[model samples]
Target: RVRSASYGGTQMRYRLQAGATELHAAAPAMHAHAPGNEVTLALPPERLWILPVEQ
Candidate 1:
């Protein structure tokens, strides 16, 4: 999970991997002054893969 703050709002990126495949997903652009202070995305287990291991 990676979070970035911008002038307008914040952006989050989540990447998941399964076996040799990887899945990258992120939330929609959330504008400032929005209602919620937190945003969440529910992803399937198979679709969520952790970062690749570096050698």
Candidate 2:
């Protein structure tokens, strides 16, 4: 869960990978993301929930 701060406005890029499979995602941070505002990151079901080991 991404808890955005008050008066937040920025672009966020996220990348997730497992083994040979990888996923890239981007979201537009809204300026109105203030107070109780939050952004939730949902992962794909096809990918297994494993630890990402960097080589």
lDDT of 2: 0.46
Candidate of highest lDDT: 1
Model 2, span 1-55: residue lDDT tens: 3233322246554443444654444556542333333344466778546567889
TM-score of candidate 2 to 2 decimals: 0.27
User: TM-score for all predictions?
Assistant: 0.29, 0.27
What local lDDT score does residue 48 receive in model 1, on the 0 to 100 scale?
A: 75
Off by over 4 Å in 1: 5-25, 28-36, 53-55
**Best by the TM-score measure:** 1
